[model samples]
Each structure stands twice: as structure tokens, then as C-alpha cells.
Target: MSKGLKGKLVLAISSRALFDLSESHQVYLTQGIEAYRQYQIEHEDEVLEPGEAFPLVKKLLSFNASLGRDRVEVVLVSRNSADTGLRVFNSIQHYELAISRAAFSGGRNPHPYLNAFGCDLFLSTHADDVRSALDAGFAAATILAGGTRRAQSNELRIAFDGDAVLFSDEAERVYQAGGIEAFQVLERESARSPLRGGPFKGFLEALNLLQREFPDDACPIRTALVTARSAPAHERVIRTLRDWDIRLDESLFLGGLDKSAFLEAFAADVFFDDQAGHCERARQVVATGHVPHGISNPLRDLPAD
Candidate 1:
């Protein structure tokens, strides 16, 4: 029988997110593909150091040891041509990562394959691919090589930003144009209303399903919603979760506070947010991924408003 992803927790991660390709990336940026390809070929035997999401991926894979089954699947999604990907595969073997599948798209967009793999989450260092994956209705994030921290908890704690992330960018558009006061009024007015599902909603729902597999008190999966909304604004979020029938283990309504210290305390295995500023801040304390979708990232021809 062929292996399938429907019953597993699937993740499609980019080579850049899985391993440190900075030197090679800089070569690609400065010299071009020829040099970069040569560099990768020359260093094919050199194992890669862990990138921001490496630790989290390792921990996630570790769960399989106890489950005695393929409860998780992490697939490599990369822009590297097949010729240049040997180094990455070698590094994966060196690290003994359980990633058995990969999509090498050369220089083209590779995100379109995410769904075929039943990817619950897609993490890449490429912002364009992240946006495209999100637009294509996958839970995607742009992994940054910062805020890689040591996890103190045994549970797989995954945290996410609310607006433009787990929830639609609708409220974010209002806030972006009207500022805090107007946005607060809108949220207050719609306190009873549930926000539309956003890019990461599917991933959250899938994660909840995994949580249900084990006893609540001892589930290996723990999720958090860390957003900038506070008080009167908090009702909609609470109601939305209730409406979705999904329960988050924790929530932080920061309103306007910096999320770094709090996330550090939370010791999140990974944090996802649409805002680069927030991602930058949170990445200093936890593995962070930037969701470059919605109003914040305006495409050349599209109106962000």
C-alpha cells in the first residue's frame, strides 16, 4: 500500500527553513545560481547546522519514537534544483530526520505541491512562496533564522497571531486604515460575531484533531493565540473560538505590548505572525515564522486596502 498523509500530521518545509543555507544563499544573491550550485556540490558532504525551525522539527519527529507509527510527516519543499539538493538530502540523512519526501522546483514556485502532500503547515524562508501558499489556502509561514530557543516544555507548543493569521485579515484591514480607536469600535460592535477563518485556520483545526487523539490533560499538542488585541476587543476572539468549536490551550491579548518576553516565557516551539515587526521581535525568543499575507504586504498590482 502507498503511504498517505491524511491520517498524519503533515508539514512541508523548505530547505532554507530546515538547514542553514545562508552562505549558499548569499552566493546565490551575490554571484548567481552557477556559483551557488557549485558551492552546494562542493559542500555536499558538509552537514548543515540547524536553522530556526530545526529544533521544533526534531522534537516533532521524536514523538514517532513513542507512538511507534508515522504520526508526523515533514516533507522538504525547496527551490533548489535537483543537482543542488543533494547537499540538503545528505544533511537530512546526517541529522537523521525522518523527512522522506521532497519537492525540488528549481527556480520556480514550489508551493502548489503543498496540498498534494496534505500539508497541515508550510514553512519556508521565501516570503513569496509563503504568500502564494496562503493564497492557495494552505497554512504557510516564512521562517526566519532568529529567536531559535530551547524548549523547556515536553509538549509541542505552537503559537500563532490572530488577525491575518488564524483569522481573516478583515479586522486587520479595519485597523490598518482606521487606527486603534476605530478598530476597537468595530471589534466592540461585532463582539458577538465570529471572524471569518484565515490562512492558518486549517492548520489550527488539524492540530486540534491531533490534540483529541490523547487525553486532554496529557495531550502532546498545545496551541496558543498571542495577538495584539485586548479587552473589549477580546470578546470576538473568545466567541470566534467558541463558534469554531476549537479550544486553544492559552491566549494572550497583548493589546499593544511587545510579545518577545511573553513568548520567551511561553517557550513556544514555533510562533507565526503576519507582521514582520512582531515576527522579528518574537523570533528572538522562539522559532518565528512571518505570514506575509493580507493588508501588510501589498503586491505590485493589488490594492492592500
Candidate 2:
């Protein structure tokens, strides 16, 4: 929504981020929401403690906003029970920080259900849930296996594409489907038109909160936009970011050139793009993510590694 959240670091933590569950405790989660529902019904008045997951959530949240105020948003999602959401929210509030959003599937199958929340990143128990969320639109991961390690730093350097990452993919979709000729015509016609909100808008707002908290003249979290559009087509991108009052540390409009070099020089920790070619190339330089265009890719249908 803010043109792009290129340089911002977004860390998504789940209820599981606060505590660890034993093998027995994990049985209900594995069984899905039905098992959780039964457990809650049996022990209506029982209150669950914030397991080992709570401290990690606090650590990540604190690291994100360490330089200033309200820089991080902890979105609490639960499928354990209705009461589980309240319990997690209360724990977060105990630290004087509120949960950004809450989502519950009421089913033990957390993967399919949590996918609907549109989290930028997901911290949860299921490894498959992390993969699904990443495949959707968010950079998701499980809390275990070093998922939160890379995100521990406050000074995160992130890269994003302009058209789809920040603004709506409507125009880019037209371009990709119709070709350069049609794209130019559309851009010329829509010179005065504004773009719509993107998947990263809410994530950008969260970063803005971080920026406001620090308010340093220099940007602590560096961001860059490596886009294919140039000159005139770039006006909308600039205007949109300015209008939203979002600040980008760096921006490059490379018309038709490859972006791998710029990304390498920037030393970006992660780069996201809808084009597999771009992500493939950027991966050689940084930890890259291929954002599925919500369109089919005939080439990548092979079984997962």
C-alpha cells in the first residue's frame, strides 16, 4: 500500500512462539482443531500457560522495535481453541504490547486455516504451514529450526519489486499477459490514475510504525526497489510511496537490465519478486523468495525437494 516495503524487516510470531509443547501436548495440534475443541470442552475452566514460545516472541518483538517505539506487530494466530486466542492475547498484553490481529480456524488443520490470515511471515508448529504461507503471499516460517534466527536483528535489509510487491499487480499482470506494447499503452492512459493496495500494505504500515518510533534522520533499516519500469512509468511508483509517507532507502528502475548486480552490491538479506527469473538470479546473491504470481507456472510443477 505504501508503494513498497522494500527495506523493512517484518517478523511474524505465532502463539507457539511463546512456548514449547511436549510430544503429548503436540498430539492434539497434530490431530487438528477437532481434538483441540474436545480438550477445551472437557476442561472449560482450565487456563493454559504461555509455554516456551512466549519468551522467543518477546525477544523478536523487542529486537524489531529496539531502536524506538511500536515498530513491530505480533499477530497471534491459534487453532488450539477459542480460549487459546484470548490466552495468547492476554500474555502479549501483559508485556504492554497488543496483538496486531487474531485468527482461529477451529480446526486442528492449522496449515490451510492459518493461510487465510495474510500474515507476512508465520511462526508456528507445522513445517508445512510455513511452506504454505510462503507460497501464498507471506514470508512464513516455523519457530523451530533457525526460522527466527535470521530475523533476530533490528537492522534488516530487505528488497522488493515495485509493481506487485508494493502496488497492485493489476497493471503488471496486464503487462505480463499483453506484452510491452499493451503495457506502454496502459501506462500512458493511466498516467493520472492511482494504483490499488498490495499484499505488503499492512506490512508497510507496520514498518512505518517502526520508523516513527526511531525517527532518526538516517534510515536504520535499508530498503530498495529493483523494478523493470523506467522514467514515465516510474512516476506512479514515486507518487504512491510519497503519498503514503513511506520512505525507501534506495530505489532502482532498470528498465530492462538484470537486477542481480544491484542486489549483490546492496548486500540484501532477502529479495522477493514475482518473476522466477529474478528470484532465481537474486538467489545467487542473497536469500531470495519467489512470490508465486497467483498464476500458473508450467515449468515448476515438479515434486518438492
Candidate 3:
């Protein structure tokens, strides 16, 4: 089958994720929508600061020039009305981003349009929108606002957790119910069985397609698997990826070690993990996206609000 977006890796990012909107968001929360609208209009000439996902987006777009073709597409998906979204567009012009497409939903949820955009990934600051996209089986993450450091390197390094992000949460459910010992036992026994694909599997596959466009030694994109599994449990993950025919450049099996420092050493532009605690720690060093998926996410265990 022919790919959507002409075989480009399409990403739909919320305006708040592309540019910092803390001040404007505070205005809306404290004053009201009218004041917030006026504030955006007043500052329409001012270019907004880059948000958490800006660096990643920039790196993704750089592929077009390097590869001599349009290999990636980034679309703006914002909750702002067109009138109030002028500043965002102006900022894009100021930054010279190649993004020419957008969806201004006014105040409505924008996840419904993700399918129309053929988005492989959705990054947003709004948790509700992220959850909605994930529910619809799209690779989505809530961009964390806590990261202070950014990668300065040209290589785009992306790290992902194994269970629940790349592979299904079946192992995670066992861990949550039976602890690490049982989890290891299950993994040991299931070493020959291929794990089910998680939501991010498709996203990783899309990324792998792009990576293959360049020669192995010259590829600009680097991917890593930063997982907590180690030793006896590692065989299944290796077999699983082999089964899927996906190749990750680096794989770190930390075996319950804190992933922040290792992720820092990797100099990742962005890291995705289903565990909130891992994301929280990771954001202190690198841009982090909380997947909010699988058994690790507490919200999934709770009743819908």
C-alpha cells in the first residue's frame, strides 16, 4: 500500500508544544479567554520562545535538506483560534520552520483531525488530547515542561522504553501484579515468543524507514532502547525486535537503574517512556515525553472520569 503524506514521516505537534505558552496559559487561567485572546493579539508581532519539542522538530525537518527531498512533515495542531494563532504562525516564519499546515480548533479537541493529517506521532502539552489520540491507537505523548537542557548536537537521538512503548504491556501487567521476580520468570519462559507490538511500534517502523534512506555510517538519525530489563529477560526483547525486523542502534538494559544519567550520556533530543517517574527524572536532563500508556500509567487502572 502507498504511504500517507507521500511516504514522509508526519508529526502533528500542538502549538504549545512547538512554542512556550506558559505566560499566555497563565493569563487564560487567571484572567479569562478574552484577556488571553487580547494578549496573543497584542503580542502577535512577538516571536514565541521554542518549547520542549522544538529541537526535535528542527532535527526532523533537517532531513529534507540533507536527504535532498521532503522526508518528514510537521503539522501544527493547536486549540487556539486562527485570530489568536497569528503569533504562532509569525514565530514559525521568524524561525523559518518548513511547517505550512495547521489545524486551529478554537477550543475543541484536535485529536480527531490527527487521522486526516496522517500523523504518525502527536506531541501535545494537553494530557486529555494526548490520551484521546492514544485511545484511537495513534502514537502520542504528552510533552513535559520540566526539561531545561537541550541537545546541541546535529544528530537526532531518540530513546524509547521497551515495554508498553515499543512492546505490549502484557509483561508490565505481570510486573505490576507479581513483582520483578515473576516478571523475570515470565520473560525467561517466553524468551522464544515474540511480544505483541505496542502503540509506538508503528512510529518506530516509520522512523526505521527514514533511517534506512541513508547509509549505515552516514545516517543522521540514531535510535536507542533504554529499558529496565537485563540478563535473562533481554533475550525476548532482542527476539521480538528481530521478529518485527526493526533494528535499534543502541540498546541499554539498565536492570532497574535510574535512566536519567544514561539518557543524558546518550544526549537524546527526546525520550519516550510509559512510566511517569522515568519521564519525570528524564526531563531533568533531556526533553521527555510521557507516553501515558500501558499498566504503568495509573490513569489506565482508574475508571473514566
Best by lDDT: 3
Query: Which segments of candidate 2 are over 4 A away from where they belong?
Result: 1-10, 13-65, 68-120, 123-154, 295-305
How close is each model in CA RMSD to the real structure?
3.2, 8.3, 2.3
Per-residue lDDT over 187-293 for candidate 1, one digit per residue giving the tens place of the 0 to 100 score: 99999999999988888987787778778777787888999999989999999999999989999999889998888777788898888778777877888888878
Q: Provide the lowest-lDDT 10-residue window in model 2.
A: 141-150
The Cα error of candidate 1 at residue 18, in Å, is 0.2
All candidates: TM-score: 0.93, 0.59, 0.96
- Clashes in candidate 1: how many? 1
Ranking according to lDDT, highest score first:
3, 1, 2
Candidate 2 lDDT over residue span 1-305, tens digit each: 22122334445555664544343255564886566555545543444455434543454466554555444555566555566455555555666654566656554545553334434455565545544664555644333321122334446576778676567787788887998888888877777677775655555666655556555765456778888888778877777788787877788999979988887767665666656666656666665545443332333532121
Candidate 3, residues 1-305, lDDT tens digits: the string is 22447688999999999999999999998999999999999999998999999999999999999999998999999999999999999999999999999999998999888888888999999888888899998999999987856637679999999999999999999988999899999999999999999989999999999999999999999999999999999999999999999999999999999999999888888999988888879989889998888877766432221
Query: Which has the higher TM-score value, candidate number 1 or candidate number 3?
Result: 3
